[model samples]
Structure formats: C-alpha cells, structure tokens
Target: MKIKEAILGFMREQAYKPMDMQELSKIFDINKEEYKTFKKAIKSMEKEGVIVRNRNDKFGLPERMGLVSGKLQVHSRGYGFLIPDEEERQDVFIPSSFMNGAMNGDKVIAKVLKEDVKGKKCEGEIIRIIDRANKTILGVYEDSKNFGFVVAEDKRIQYDIFIPRQKKGDAKTGDMVIVEITQWPEKKRNPEGEIVDILGKKGEKGIDILAIIKKFALPEEFPDKVEKFAANIEEEISKGEYKRRVDLRDVRMVTIDGEDAKDLDDAVSIERLPNGKYKLGVHIADVTHYVRENNPLDKEALKRATSVYLIDRVIPMLPRKLSNGICSLNPKVDRLTLSCIMTIDGSGKVVDHEIVESVIKTSERMTYTDVTKILRDNDEELIKKYDYLVDDFKAMEELFEILNHKRLQRGAIDFNFEESKIILDELGKPVDIKPYERAVANRIIEEFMLVANETVAEHMFWTKTPFVYRIHEEPNEEKLHHFREFIYNLGYVMKWSNEVHPRALQDILEKVKGKKEETVVSTLLLRSMMQAKYAPQCVGHFGLAARYYCHFTSPIRRYPDLQIHRIIKEFINGGLTEERIKNLTSIVEYSSRQSSEMERIAQEAEREVDDLKKAEYMSERIGEEYEGIISSVTSFGMFVELPNTIEGLVHISDLNGDYFIYDERHLALIGERTKMMYRLGDSVKIKVTKVDIDNREIYFRLTEEDHEDEELEIHDDIKESLKSGIYEEKVMAIETGYHDEVE
Candidate 1:
C-alpha cells in the first residue's frame, strides 16, 4: 500500500489512538531521510479528510474522532444530510444553522452532534470545509436596489446569490445567467457572485435546457480536434483486416431500437442448433476500433462518459461522425463488432460461448413499436410486412422467456416503475406527456443484453484480466429492516434482521404487481437498495441477482462499454502483455470512476429536464380535473400521481371541507369531524391549481368529495402556512436526495 493508504488503514484500527506525525513515522519505520516524505503523506491525508487533526495536531480517522466526512446534500429548505464517505455509516442530518458556510455538494467534515443505535438518523454540524463543488451558479436574475438576486435553478441550493449591480454585465431582470461566486455564504447572508454569462431571457425556446447543460458542466459541443479525428476515421476495412476477423456477414441479424433512435449500437441474431440448443449472438458496435486508446475522439468520449438524452436534444458522447455515421450498426452496411455467441440449453444456461471480433451486415433495422405489434398484438399485417425476419423474431421471444424465467428463479428483484415521455412541440414547448411502457419487444432486448453482459463479465473474470464491472453491492441492513417493517404495517409478513435474500423482496413485488400501491412499494424498495455503478471489483449485483455483470453493449453511448471493448479486443488479438496489463490497471480504475461519476451527472440532467417539461405541460392545464392515486402522505399533504406518471402535491390546506389530521402509521390523512380518510393508494380526483416552472413544482386541490357536503371550513393554521410556502418546502424536503432511476 501507498503511504497515504497505509496511514488511513492504520488509523482505522479499532484500538488505534490519535498519534502525532513522529509517532506514526515510528510505527511505519521511517528513517531520517524518509521523514519529510512520510510527513507530506500525512498532510495530504488530512487535506483529503481521510484523517482528522485534533487541536494537538494528532491524526486519527474522522469517525473515531466523532466526525463525519462526506458530501453535503442540502435540501431546498436549507437543511441538509451528510452522505458519509465511510461505507456502513448512516447519513447524518445537518440543520441549516449547523451548516456554517458550506454550500451544497461541498465536501466537509462535520462534528457529530448526536450518535445513536444503528437505524436512527444521526445529527451533525459542519465544522470544516474540505472542498468546494460550486464555483459558479446558474439561475434567474432578479434586479434589486443596489444588487441583483439570482435564484438558483436547482432547488437543493436554497440560497439566492447576491449579485453586485456593476457586475451584472448585459443582464437584466428575468434573464437567465451563470454567475461566478465571489464570496461564499456566511450565517444568513447569501453567497455573493458576479454575472459571467447572460444566456438569454428566462422563457426562451432553448434557454431552459441550455441552463441545465451548463449546470452539469456538460460539453456544449465537441472540440475541433476531436471532431476532425472522428471525421477522418476510415469507414472501410482492408481485405487483410477482414481476413483476420471472424466474418459473420452471412448472419441474418437485426437491430432493434426506439423509433427515433439515431445511434444503433447493438444487434441480435439467434438460431436453433440440431441438438435442440440455441445459439445466440449479441453483436455490439466496435466503437474502440475508430476511437483508439488515447486518441482525441477517445479522450473526448471518456470525458463525456455517457450520452445525455434530454427530451429536446441529445448530447452524444462521441461526435456524430462516429456515433451516427460510420460506427452505427446501420442496416445493409458492413460494420465491425465484438460478438458474444453463446450456446444455450433449453433452461437458458450458457453451455458454451465465444467472444470474438467480427464483421456483419444487418439484415434489417427494426423498431420496438412494430415488433411489439407483431408479437404482442398479433397484427397480421405487420407480421407479413416483416416476413423475412419473422422467424428470428419468434426465436428471440422463445429465448426471452427462457432467460426471463431463469432470472426470476434466481431471485432477481425487478422494479417496474412507469416512466413518462414528455412530448415537445416544434418550438420545444411541452405538447403532452404519456406513459412509456415496457412491451414484449423491449423486454426481449433487455434480456438479451443482460445475458450478454453477464457472459462477457464472467469471461473476463476467469481470464484474470484488468476489467471494469457493473456492480450493485448489497443493500444496507438498516434500510432492509426498515423496508420490512414498512411493508408489514401494510399487512405483509417478512423477517428481517442481518440479511434478507433478493428472493424475499422479489416475492413481495410479485404479490403487489397489479395493485394500486405497486408504484409506491416498488419505488420505496428501490430506494432501500444500493445504487448500481461501474467498479473494478466483481462484487456481484444485488438487483440483478447476478454473480457477474458488465456493460458489453451500446459502446457508442456508454464509455465503460467502449473502454472494455478495447481491453477485450486486446485479449482476443493476443496483445495483453504483462506490461500492458500493468498500464491498463490504472486506466481501468480511472475509466471506472469517471464513467460512474459522469453517468450520475447525465441521469440528474435528464431527470431535471423531464421534471421541468412535465411542470410546463401541467402549467397549460390548470383547473383540469384528473384521476390520480395518493402516492405518499406527509405533514403538508398527500402527493397524487396521475396515470401518465406526473406527480403533484395536494397540500393539506386544499383538503377544503373538514379539518384533517395526519396518521403516520397508515400514511393517511383523516378528517376529524366527518371521519373521512384518504390513505396511500386511494383514488382521488384533483384539479391542477398552480405551477412553479422555475422550481418544477406542481400543486393540486382535491375535487368535490363527500366532505364537501358537510359544513365547509378551512383550517386557518393550514391556510396561514400555505401563504408562507411552508407546504411546498416541507414536501420538497421529504423528496430531497431521493432522486430517479432504478438501473
């Protein structure tokens, strides 16, 4: 281990005590000449918050010193939670006053105000800032007397930036701008900044998305060098090169994607062997062939890591010349790929497999919509239209069933949360929103990809090669226990303590599949599990219940896939020398970390854009009544989710006729006078009352109900709180840190 890691490991000992630099040097057996270097390592550890220095300049682990070092996730209510850096530690609650001057996303060492038993939330106060994440802020500019205020676009950033008038160059009230922070917040004072870039007026056609792009620090365009490199890549392969590769040009394969998909990165082919076994081939776009290691295009792809699919436009990882032109597995064109061909038994076990670099010409470019119509709807016309590839489609369905059954039998917990697709008009305004479903065709592709990923991951693992993996570590025991109790409160039975298998959770999901509470339960269960990420270790994936997994498909869009493709090609071509493997260790580690971080950024950007557009869509329909299910009950009120997957708050004050009291156990609001109650999963009619586009907030009021016949009386206290925006703030607090996506 390096000196830094050694210092941290030593300090993590259960019986280790705080020690000075000289004492630590003695423990490590450092000589006079090595003392300076050893001392520098200790200082570096201190700066990184891996170790805390007490008043006596003695070092120890932060947790041992009653301190938590983590990224502060401040809610819009000004309060925040410390997501601890140390695994197994609980997230510490940090109240606004205890935040000192730290802003959202700042890495800080917080002094523990309270520590208790395992499951309960611990409280803390930020005592020192380790790193600042926000150097600039993006928001709307509101002019003031001598200064302007910029309300941050992210609700999690509670404070409005104070901007000096002279520094607000070319910006006026209601203009969208990016401001560079000149001073960080202290006490009740907001951080001070100067306008850096005046994007445009607030309501412009594309300014909203532009702000989101800049907020995530995403690349607005490719560098000229990267673009030129992509443009110059050869689209054709030499005869000698074709001769060396396992050519599969005669294989009748098809690419299936969404109707509007531009980058076709994967294709599938399958045929039944004479022995009643199935040979499945998953061909992925060989993006690394053109985007070679350390090239401008490769560097740019790694930097971006993943494509950001905003509803308005796509910020692709690679330049269009590669992502859409040569690299895309377009139909009827010879394309290169790294194929995983598996020979599977009737039970979906991969009896044999081969990972090879090959060339192929796609037989057809199909779509999920059309394929679903043929298989699910039994549309004769569509089946006839694709007569040439109908047999392949049937074979795919048969294999999907076998794979799906195998996964379910293995206790894979599948969370089926409905997704919304925001439709935009020509000018980028929200036209409508609809629920996006997972049809048979979509599931087939998903199953195939999952199997291919597992196959490649297992192959790489056995080879003892340096590789990046998609790992989903086991869930926290505390969270699993909490989920068990919560479900039991709803009349379910389960045992939870140290560990619960994925099969137990899968069974519960099956029971609630078609129930009104399915979405809520699924969402909460997903939150209880750990997030999936790219890592260098093969720890296994909890959600998939898989022993091995990796991103082996869609290399055109995901960097991990592209990065691994190069490694796989090297191994297949017999060039993975010991020296080369040593170099690749660092490369794989860096790529894994970068890919995971960038994926998070892209997911957040996409979710924020979707929320913004959804709010815009609802804003145009104020007062329109819609049927919805009460998704959650809180102190403010219950949140209702419409059939199309749009969620809006129904504040307590809006429950007009009778005074209501919240019941935490059952997650319901009961009217005291009339004994009327609305519980989680209860159907209710609501009319859109208000929309806050800047904050992406939607408000609703319950339609006329049984309580309306009783004496009409609104609670004066609730009304007073609503006027002060207390309702929205409390609801937003409940939603903080619990964002979107399951996989």
Candidate 2:
C-alpha cells in the first residue's frame, strides 16, 4: 500500500489515537535509513490536511483534531467559506483575519472557532493550505513608475497581483494580461507575479471575450497539425466507405437549428407508418469517420470537450473544417451519420429501434423561426415556401406532443427558464438584451434528440459495454430540506418523506405555474439539484427522470458524444474484442471525468461573457426606471429581475419608509416601524442606480413611490404573528401560489 493509505489504515485501526513521529516510525517498522522518508510523508499528509497535530503534539486525522478539510471559496470582500468535501458537512465561514496565508480557491485545513449555533454561521480558521487552485490570473494591468499591479477580472480574487517593472513584459497599462504568480501573499504583502502575455487593450472589440477565454484557459485555435489533418480529410464519402455503410442518402431528413448555427450535428426524419405508428429517425454526424482515435484532431477535440457559446461568438470544440464542414449535416450534401431509427406507437412507446451507420443527404436546412412559423403559427407564406414538407412538419408536431406527454408522465422536471440573448453590433457592443424564447419547434427537436439519446444509452448499457452516461444524482437531504423550507415560505407545500422524488418537486412547479413566483421558484429549485455530469456508470438522471441518458446527438460540439460515437462505431463493426475492451475501459473513464470538467469550464466562461455583456448593456441604460419582480431577498438587500431578465440588487438602506428587518424564514425584508414588507415575487419599480462594469454588477434603488406607498403595509397582528413564527406553519398549509394571497 502507499505510505499515505497505510498511515490512514493504521490510524483507523488504532481508533484514530494520536501518534507522534517516533510511535509511527516504530509501528511502521521504519529503520534509521527510512525514517527521513517516513517523516516527509507525515509532513506531506499534515500539509494536505489528511492528518493534523493535536494539542498533545501527536498527529491524527483532522476529525480527531476538531478540524475540517475543504476548499475555500473567497468572496470579493476578503472573507471566505470552506465548502466541506463531505456531502453532509455544513460550510464553515472563515473570517478574513482567520484566513492566515490561504488565498481564494485553496484547499485547506481549518479549525472550528465556533460550532453551529441557531441562526448564525459556523466559523472556522484556516490552519494549513493543501493546494492552490490557480497559478495564473487574468486581469487588467495598471502600470506604475517602478512596479505595476494586475487587478483580476474575477472579483472573487481579493488581492491585486504586484508585477515588477522588468517583469511587465510587453503589456502596457490598461491592457488585459495574464499574470503568473511567483510568490503567494504574506501577512502584509500582495501576491507577487510577472506578466505572462498581453491579450489586448481593454474595451477592444473582441478583447473582452478573449480575456474570459484566457481566464478559463480555453483554447481558441486548433494546432497547425490538427488543422492540417482536418483540412486534408476527404469531404466526400468514397465508394469503399459507401459500400461499408447503410445507404440512406435518399431519406427525407432535415437539419433544424438556429440560422446562425453552423455546426449542424443532428438531423431528423419522421414517417407515419401504415400500422398507425411513427418511425422517427435521428441522424447524427459521424465525426469519428475522419477524426480517428489518437489523431491530432481527435486529441484537440478531447482536450476541448465542449464548444463555448459566448454572446457574440463560439469557440468550437473542433476546427471549422470539421465542425462546420465535413461533420456538419448540411443540406443536399452526402454525409456520414450514426442514425437511431425508432418505431414508436401512437402513445409514444419505442416499440422497436435500430442503431445503424449510414450515409445521408439532408433535404433542407430549416431554422427554428421558419419551422415555428409553419407549424405553430401556421403562417401561410412559410407553408407556401416549404410546401413540399408541410405534411412531414405536421407529422413531426404530432410525434413531438406524444413524446412530450410521455416524458411529462414519467415525472421529468422541466424548468423552462428563458435564457438571455444579447444582440451585438459589428463592433461587438451590446445592442440589445432580451429573453430568448423557446418556441414549439425547439421542443420538437429536443424531444427527438432526447429519445434518440436514451435509446442509444439503453442499447449500450444492456450490452454490458463500458460507456459514458449522463448522470444526475438525487438531491441530498439538506438541500431538499432547505428547498422545502424556501417553498413553504412562499405558501407552497411539497410532499416530503425520507427521500425526495422529482415528482414532488415537479408537482410543486405545476402548482406555481403562471404565478408571479414561478420563475423564482424554478430557479431556486434548479439550484437545489445536483449538476448532470458524464460518468462511466449509469446512475439514472434525476431531472429528466430517465433510466438511460447520454449525449449521443451533437458529436461535433461535444466531446463525450464524439467519444461515444467512436465506441459505437467500433461495436457496430464487430463486438468489442478483449484487447479493445481493455483499452476502452480506461479511456471511457478518463474521458468521462475530463469531459465533465471541461464542460464546466466552458459553461463558466460562457456565463462570464454573458454577464460582462449584460453589465455593459445595463450601463447604457443607467437612470432608466423599470418595473421588476423581487427575485430574492437577503439580509443586506433584495435582488430584482426586470422583464428583460437583467437582475439588479436593491439595498436594504434604500427602503426608506422604516428600518427594514430581514426575516429569514419568510424571505422578506420587514419594516420595523411601519410593518411594510418586500418579499420575493413582489412587484416594485427600480431605477438603475449604478452599474459596476468591472464587477459585472448592477445596483438599484426602489422608486420613491414604492417606498412611500401606505397600501403596501401589513397589519400589526400579522407582524406579531410572523415575529413569533406562528403564521409560517399556517401559511405553509395554505394553498396559495400568488404572493398577494398571503396578504
């Protein structure tokens, strides 16, 4: 066994009794020659927080030392919270003074200063730093005479990195740069670093997005060899390739996507069977055909894992030559595909299915807008334009409804929150920001892709073949308890037992449909659930309520899908040989973890870009008044989300009628004197008070009328009942979805 594991085992056997170096050395039979190595291992373990020294001057596990080991999440204000790696452990708050030398995102050992008390945060002090999260930080350089500092773009990084004059490199003041840390901060010193590379000037057209790309370490361009390989691949299928695959080029398939989407990785074709069933064909681009295993292109795609969709552009997983060229299921061009053909009955049951490698020719490239106009809106002009495919479109609509109904019946939790769509001009300045509505056409494609993915996953799973599966574990008890309390405060009761099911949450969502708090409730519920990730094991997805799930649809944009495509191709050619299976077992496991981590990085980068652009958009609208709904209420303030989906904070100090007292249980800011309250989902007018471009934050103040309105006051008896916590239980039992119903 490894030294660390051996030490842990020995400690566990000893009932976690404290052991000094000499005792451990004697117990492990360490000779004089090996004692130095043994001591080094113990020190390493201590530094990693795996073992700690107690007041008795003997080492034991952190639990025995009354310490916790977790990753530190630092706030911009310098204080941080240690999120314990243990699932059930509560986060311990670390005050700035107790941080020692640990920085943001450090994995550290902490000693509890104060135990969890009612209505108070658990406090802790960092005792040791185990690991650092980042060695390089992306920021804007501010040059001075003898030295300079780089202020991090990420606000969570509390310290500005100090760069020596000679280490500034080619970067100038106000230039966006990447700084590599040479020395960490001490008691009275900032982090010392040197400029690595200058991205570009701040406020440049594409520089803002580039800064986020650099921050996340997302590769923007493919390597020369990878690009060359992709460019040299034959665009057309050869005669030998055609003979090896099922020829379905004559099949009436159509690629449905947004107009600007170039990576059309999936296409659909549906036929009404004479037996009153539907044959749904989901054809996905077979990217593995040209990008073979262990090739440069394949390696690059594996590293990328997923494409990033920013406000103005996309950093594709594959080169444009493959992603937007050969791999894209373009119209009227012969392309290779792995198709899932399912025979579904009228009730949307997959009676029979076949997964095949085929060559296909897309009949048309249809945009969501055009398809929605033709099918949902029944626009005559669009119907005329696509006269040849109206019946097919109608058939697709029929199957979509049937499939959607089947999914809903299975207790799938669908949180249909509108995404923010920012439109930019040629210069990349935000021209408008609005909610991107999902039309019925989008749902039709989604339903098709989901069924195909599930079918493919089930097929592979039953074969006992190693593969990547999209897994969403059930929410933990603590999160569910908090969610239950939150929803209960809003006058909604969810059926709870020893275990929380998706249906319970789904049912609550149904109850709140069309209510003012629907969006807020949905967002909170989403936050409560665990993130879906690619795993080597099939742990059925909780949100989708699916026993089998995989990303088998978009191979061009997602690496997991591409990796599975390669495995499916190998299986189709022949059952996996022992040699191939052995090789694939490790590959699949590694790919699952790498892809999950990369996907998260891409998502975070995308969100950062979106937030930056949104802040810039709101900056232009400063002083403009807008009607908004209270999305969340905290002790310091309430966050209000406008109709356009731009959220801004309204500070507690701005609620001027009376001193506002925060009620945690009710999720409201209650006025001490007048008994006026501002709760989640309450409508209020707010002016864009200030926009912090650097921090990507918008600050707001309640309109004077909202503060002075006497009609918004609550009765004294109700206030007294709330203060005593007597009304909360009654409110929970009251079946009221509207916020005004409580009043």
Number of clashes in every candidate structure?
A: 0, 0
Clashing pairs in 2: none
Q: Mind giving the per-residue lDDT tens digits that candidate 1 earns over 1-743?
A: 77887777888789899999888999999999999999888888888788889999898988788899988888777688887888677788888789999988899999999886563467889999988989988899999888888998877787889888898887899999999999998887889999999999989889989999988888989999987877778777879769888999999999999999999999999998999889999999988888898989888899999999999799999999888988899999999889999999999999999999999999989999999998888889988899988888989999999999999989999888878888898999999899998999999999999999999999999999999999998886756766777677666777545677788899899988898778777866887888899988899998999999999998999999998999999998876889998999999999998999899989989999999999999999999999999887776788999999999999888787677777554456767656466777777888899999888999998887634646433344444534585533212234333322112
What lDDT tens digits, residue by residue, belong to model 2 across residues 1-743?
Answer: 77889999888774657878999899999999999999999999887777888767799877666889988877766678887766477778888888887887788889999997883657899987788887899999998888999999887787899999999998888999999999998777889999989988998878888888888888878889988888788786789989989899888989999989999999999899999999999999999998789999888888888999986778999999888888898899999999999999999899999999999999999999999999878899989988989999999999999999998888899888988888999988999889997998899999999999999999999988889999999985655777799887667889867777788889988999999889888877886788789999998999999999999999899999999999988887888988888889989999998898788788878878888988999999889999999998776788999998889999887778788777666677777667688887888999998998878899999888786686795645457786886753211211111111111
Whole-model Cα lDDT of every candidate shown, in order: 0.86, 0.86
Candidate 1 residue pairs in backbone clash: none
Q: After superposition, how far is residue 396 of candidate 1 from its true place, in Å?
A: 0.8
Q: Against the hidden reference, what TM-scores do the models get?
A: 0.91, 0.89
